[model samples]
Target: MPASLSGQLVVAISSRALFDFEAENEVFEAEDDHAYMALQQQRLDEPALPGVAFSLVKKLLAFNNGGPGSGQRVEVVVLSRNDPISGMRVFRSAAHYGLGIERGVFTRGAAPWRYLRPLSAQLFLSTNEADVRSALAAGVAAARVMPLSRQASAEHPGELRIAFDGDAVLFSDEAEQVYQRDGLAAFREHESERARQPLPAGPFKPVLEALQRLQHEPGMRIRTALVTARSAPAHERAIRTLMDWRIEVDEAMFLGGLAKGEFLREFEPDFFFDDQAGHVESAAAHVPAGQVAAGIAAG
Candidate 1:
């Protein structure tokens, strides 16, 4: 826990991005040439990693608490090589294996190619010195090879230090849609008047519950927070929602109209997840961030 994993960079990358998932090519005599091809294909087709490691990736991504000012918090990273072709292939095939393929670099390419033009990181499973160096230069903290093999836990201070956004992230998008359709004043009035009511759950609540379980686990690491745009009279519902959930968030802030990036830099979270591009774009600069898509709401 070391008081804080901040004052340092944190990142989330894919496993294939770090290690070569495909078996190395081997040289053999011609007698079993066909067999070799089949074997290699099988390896590529089923490059199953240890389930424990896979769970670790989820655990790390699920950790929302961590900030620069907070006590020890390791920056979580998901190492992923940017192979356009292979990445494309993986996306197309992911559903066949019952894996969830949410949008992002691997799915819809959130950080468009143009945005990444400045970096020379390799496009495939090549975690070579050049790729690593380029990624660092391009602003990736510690790179993580995604898809861990087992369930794992990242230890932080007794405090879990969770952080989240307001609007669609915490409450349902009904309010946000009003804000987008109407103006700030109207949105404020609506939220202010509706302060006593409960908001519909956001996509991350179940995941938040999972984190809460981890937080309550004996000798476990957990802390929580609510970082939102709602402030003053309108923020009551948000606070009450947490209470209703029975979750103990160590630090909660209502930014009102303040920019989240600056506060996020100060917060230094282990990993921050949001559904909006603006927040994630800004927070990614200071913390390991994941953009949970809106599709999760369908569940």
Candidate 2:
């Protein structure tokens, strides 16, 4: 058979999401690709500092160091908007950081979401909003990485920790839409009544499902959490939904509208995903965070 990424947890990440190219990103935004390419060549030997998703990427790549999985095989591909020449620096930076990323697609300025289908990427992380939206529309679990977000600490080098929000992230925005259009009381009441019904799948559902497979890989250490603003009566529905899907998280935090930053600090996740930009910004202060940009709040 042809070389394939089958039966693996495949992730597609952008050059900017994997490395700290904030300065170069600005240059690309203000000038043209030529200027950006020139700068990359000028600093060709300088390896980039790690970006927001670096820790998550590094940990996921660790699964491949052994390379055997019923589903633990992990492949991380660089799906970037940078030119082919600039891609050299991306590879060099990954090499410098010891990330074994061998596959990539450099599209210069065009949308890179077009390649997600071929890769069958379970997750797509990028700094570009348009590309992320396109990936979500195409049914790929995608997130707009917060480039300026803080990187995770090296306190736990042996395990990979990941977190996600509930409504509009792991679950559909139906309950969230009810809360937005109505009020908290109504949302709780709506959820309580339909507690047994499964909420529709959100963008990150596939990503979580893929992680579940990777979690069972021999000798792999991965932790996942469901941190949401939900609490009590409304929270029952969330739990039931996960049970309905037969998926379980290592931890679940129903903060009931409490600020999530400090709580996330305590959890010390390598990365966290939230659909609300406010929540993403809050969690970014304590842990590496990304915005899903899905549902009503994202608008």
Candidate 3:
């Protein structure tokens, strides 16, 4: 039988998203590709530092260590735009950090999101917005990783914690637009009236489902939280939607417009995902953060 990623949770991440390449990226932006390639070649032996999603990827990969006959339950592939030569450093870096990432697709400068389908990736994370948007358009769960976001706490080495916003992320932004246009009262009334109706799925729904599946596997230690700004009546719809999907998150925080940073700081998630730039900015200050640039708020 052919070696396959079937029955495995696959994640496709760009080199920049997986490691700190800001300085190298600066050269790529200011100079030409040749200069950037030269820099990467110069430091080929030096392993790059971990970036925002590093902890999340590391913890998720730990699920594969169920021993001999257990088989691999997770796969992390480097889906980068760097040339094959530059990709050498990426693989080296992963090895240096003890990450067992062995698969990759180096596209030089071409879009790498095209490979997500073949990989059966439930998640695609990159520092490049264009790549993320392309992956989303292709029906893959994608998020633009906040490269400078705060690193996750090292306190919980054995557990993986992830948090996500509700509207525009786990669910469609239909209700979010109403809140943005009208006042709070109108938004609450609208949500109350539509409480029975489940919100439409958002781009992150597929990834959430994949995580839900992973959580059920023996020896997998994963915790998920829904941290949304909706309160009271509005919260009912979001809860109902999850109930309707038969998905259960470990925790749910309906902040009712409270700043999410402090709450997330205490939660200490390996990564947090939100659609609004403001929320991402706040969470990035306290935890590793990624932005889902989809829906009306993203516009």
Off by over 4 Å in 2: 67-72
Q: Which candidate number would show the highest lDDT if scored against the true structure?
A: 3
The whole-model lDDT of each prediction reads: 0.47, 0.90, 0.92
Give the least accurate 10-residue stretch of model 1, judged by summed lDDT: 142-151
**Candidate 3, which segments miss by more than 4 Å at Cα?**
none
Spell out the clash pairs found in candidate 2. none
- Per-residue lDDT tens digits of candidate 3, residues 1-299? 87799988899999998999999999999998999999999999999999889999999898888767777888999999999989999999999999999999999999999999999998999999999888888888889999999999998887889999999899999998998899789999999999999999998888788888878665558889999999998999999999999999999999998999999999999999998889999999999998888888886
Candidate 3: minimum summed lDDT over ten consecutive residues — where?
212-221
After superposing candidate 1 on the true structure, give the runs of residues whose Cα lies further than 4 Å from its correct spot.
Answer: 1-161, 295-299
RMSD, candidate 1, Å: 15.5
CA displacement after TM-score superposition, residue 249 of candidate 2 (Å): 0.7
Error of 2 at 200 (Å): 1.9
lDDT of 1 by residue, 1-299 (tens): 43333332233344343233433223223334355445444445553432212333333433333334344222333333333444444444333333333332532223332223322212212123344334334533222222221112234433334466655555566777766778788878887887767788765565466566556333336556677776777778787777787766677888886767678667655555455656656666655544444422211
Which of the two, 1 or 2, has more lDDT? 2
